[model samples]
Target: MRYISTRGDAPALGFEDVLLTGLATDGGLYVPESLPHFSIEEIRSWRGLSYSELAFNVMHPFVDDAIPADDFRAMLEETYKEFAHQAVAPLVQLDTNEWVMELFRGPTLAFKDFALQLLGRLLDYVLEKRKQHVVIMGATSGDTGSAAIEGCRRCEHVDIFILHPHERVSEVQRRQMTTVLGDNIHNIAVRGNFDDCQRMVKESFGDQSFLGGKTQLAAVNSINWARIMAQIVYYFHASLALGGPDRSLAFSVPTGNFGDIFAGYLAKKMGLPISQLVIATNRNDILHRFMSGNRYEQHQLEHTLSPSMDIMVSSNFERLLFDLHGRDGALVKDLLERAQQGPVSIEDYRWRHARKLFDSDAVDDKLTCDTIREVFERNEYLLDPHTAIGVRAARNCRRDPAVPMVTLGTAHPAKFPDAIAESGLSIKPELPVHMADLFEREERCSVLENDLSAVQSFIADHWKHA
Candidate 1:
């Protein structure tokens, strides 16, 4: 399938190009020119397939012979083979009608690995065919860094660099990225918040003069359409597990970047029988405000116990805005550009239409902890802070009691022990067997200033080609 930029200025591109090109030349994100929709029979036929098989069926349309079919299947098989769980992404029931889809069973113990593990393999296949090498510049609030590093570190043609907020992410989050040592992998701790690191990555992508024209740049962020593509698989997986296609289901996603929930939206568009979509956020709740009240305005970023959702700007929201404005790229560009400076307004009809598509809630730190404690006491299920927010948001915003509500369990609780402790739980969440010695591992990471030019200079200086 071919992809077009949201801004409508960049040339339409095939899948391979979109996979490698992070941001469009016109400073917009790539989306499918036309999405594939399946009939009820088509979706039902996929019931008994393996996760890899199901993912191939759901995602193959997007790839569209960009990679040979057998090769693509092999890549997908290898992608999920290393996951800690046999089912890959599994479902755990909390209430009779409420469930949590555990998504942290992958190598990095986060939802990101659902996409990144396959991303690394995809890069290897394409870059090897083209005989090319590229640099990966990604910004993470917490989980994306380690998942990206784990995914790309093994690709010889990739030099991956991830930047995260200094001392803002939990100790486990930091160690997950810093402990993975390789010549091709570098981690930077920015002396600012998650938004600062994200802005620097965007600005660098806009102007790559710092690379001195030696190597091209790529993205591992949700801005890349491939990342969004990989995430869409689990939504379908969860629905099928809950007897979908015949019965409609609901999803509550804990998202800061908007990529995860945006995938759920796309799933609905692709003919999944979804009754409702919930936008679950923490105190940094631009998306929650927009969905609940039609106020698409930014507020000062807050540092929260759920550090991953501590973001002010939701990047993937622009993709939804593209549709809300009826794919008028010029209109989207105008609205988002104005949004960068101040609050921007959407048309009355568009705002009302969006309300039909979503329900939302913004949970604070206290409620997050209470929800964690409550769920543990009620069902003996220990939730990470992020997932706690999802569960809370799901229950608060649910419209129907009969429909199955699936909360996207975004991370392993072990990764956020501090947040668990704050919930007044007496038991400590232990790391998975693979990461048992995570604390004892020696970490290698550079602490960098948040200045854009300084960060760009470091990438140029240390790039393998340099």
Candidate 2:
């Protein structure tokens, strides 16, 4: 399948190319030329297969020509073999009609592991075949950095550098990334918000001279199509376990970058019987406002309990707009430009169209804590702040009594011990083996101002030393 840039300027690329060149040249995200579909019979036939098997089946269409079938299958199997759960993303019924898809079963104890684990394998395979090395630069609000660091820490052919907003992420989040002792992993604490970190990454890509000068740079964020593709497997797994296309399912995703919910959309396009995709947001609710027809306005960032969702700019939403406009890149570019200048008012019809496929709700800190307390009291379930927002949002939109609603549990509660404790729940979850003694480790990272030259210089210096 060919991938095209949302801005219509970059050359169309195949799966591997799209995976490597994350943000398109025209400052847009890449999307598939056309979505591939799967028949209901084909989806149902995958009922009892292992997660790896199911992932191979679901992702084969997208990367059929990019990677050899046997190699891809082997990679998928190897990528997930170390997961704590045999059923990689297990489903637990929270209520008669509600379930929580436990996605923190991988090494990092975050939903990002579902994709980054596979991403590490894919990167190794591709780089080995080409006999090349790459520098992976990513910006993370919280979980993505730790997951990426864990996935690519000691890999010989790839060097990963993650930039996170200083003092914005939670303590555990910071420690997870900072404490990794891998020589190849570099963490930069930027003196700005998540948007600044994200902008720096984008600027690095835009610097043609710098991009061509030294080490090859790729991104591990959801901007990489492979990351989103890998995430789609869980939706299929959850849907199939809950009777699949036979019964419609609704997903409540704790959305920040929009990639997670967009994967659900891809599942629907591929004929999964999903009724609605609910976007659960914290105070940084650009997505919520867009879906609510109050205009797609990006305000100043806010520090919230759910730090991962503390983003003013939702990057993956551009891909959705590209699809929504029927792959008309010109329209996508125009809309994005307008949205950036100010809050572009989405037409009522367009807003309703988006709302048809997805519903949105925002939960503040109080509601998040309340939901955590309530869920713990009623069901003996302990949720992190982000997952608590999702649970509350799901409860607000719980209309269909028959259709099962699945909320994507994005992170393990241990990642946010303070919030979890503040919610009046006491569950001392075991840390992942890698993070067991994070506090004891001394961190090695550069504190950088939000300047492009400084970031560029850091990359240049690192490449030169390597």
RMSD to true structure for each model, in Å? 0.7, 1.5
What's the count of clashing pairs in each model shown? 0, 0
Q: By lDDT, who's the top model here? A: 1
Highest-TM-score candidate: 1
Error of 2 at 19 (Å): 1.4
Instruction: List per-prediction Cα lDDT, in the order shown.
Output: 0.92, 0.86
How far in Å is the alpha carbon of 222 misplaced in model 2?
Answer: 0.7
For model 1, give the 10-residue run with minimal summed lDDT. Answer: 288-297
Question: For residues 1-466, could you state the per-residue lDDT of candidate 1 as single tens digits?
Answer: 8899899999999988888989998899999999999888999999978999999999999999899889999999999999998999999999989999999999889999999999999998899999999999999999999999999988999998899999999999999999999989999999999999999988888988889888889999999999999999998898888898889999999999999999988998999989899999999999988876777788889999999999988889989999999988999999988987887678879988887868999999999999999999998899999999999999999999999999999999999989899999998998889999999999999999989887888888887888
What global local distance difference test value does model 2 have? Answer: 0.86
Candidate 2 stretches greater than 4 Å from native: 426-428, 432-434, 464-466
TM-score, candidate 2, is: 0.97
TM-scores, one per candidate:
0.99, 0.97
